[model samples]
Target: MRLIRGMAGAVLLAGTGLAVHPAHAQQPGFHRHDVLQHDLSVPGREVVQVRVDFDPGAVSVKHSHPGEEIAYVLEGTLEYEIEGKPPVTLQAGQGLFIPAGANHVARNVGKGKASELATYVVRKGRPIFVVAD
Candidate 1:
């Protein structure tokens, strides 16, 4: 199981290009809603679930998670890039996993809005996300 916290920031690039920027980049047409959160049986561990929605052309700035992240696409297409890896296109019913502390970005490459369900398993008392430098 995974969990999420709060809004940190996002980087909005024009397309598939990768450009580093400050955390306060232009706002993208993206939204995140908390689905569930609870403490794990393991001490100092927690799980969070969230639904992320992206309008066409929306892009998230480079960032890292406090723990492991797993995402499943529900609608449209998404271009997901992790540091040192090629961008992968995920469509409906597809899923991906990201390890803790790996910089990554996500964009809505399809013509319409895209949505995904993300789960996080992280240490308690830590922010769910951190903006990468």
Candidate 2:
């Protein structure tokens, strides 16, 4: 139920291209939202631009990725915990990269909402996520 609402909200925001991030006006050709995406047109390779809007006290479900993930925080602060890795905090303007198969989850521990832009290089014809703990 939570996933559905979260995804729906994300979809709506993405479609409307709302205030995706404080820096949205600076980057051209990019969509804005709580979670917006702009796919990079790389032939034979998948490169997608993703934005994550995080509300205070919100934590995402634990999940694992099948591809390499790179992210940059555009606003607010995010707290991340990955399997076997010490938790880290990413403030606005920070970045991170997760290797393939790494289990991880993120939470917005800041006072306000947060946002991030991520890119993934995934295998073709397969989904990218698998729930994990």
State residue 42's C-alpha deviation in candidate 2, in Å. 8.9
Q: What is candidate 2's CA lDDT for residue 73?
A: 89
Top candidate by lDDT = 1
Candidate 2 lDDT over residue span 1-93, tens digit each: 766544433432343333331221221222334333334466544654557677677776666666788878889888889889999999998
Whole-model Cα lDDT per candidate?
0.76, 0.64
Model 1 ranges with Cα > 4 A deviation: 1-27
Give residue 5's error in model 1 in angstroms.
18
The lDDT, on a scale of 0 to 1, for candidate 2 is 0.64
Worst 10 residues of 1 by lDDT: 13-22
Task: List CA RMSD, all candidates.
Answer: 8.7, 7.8
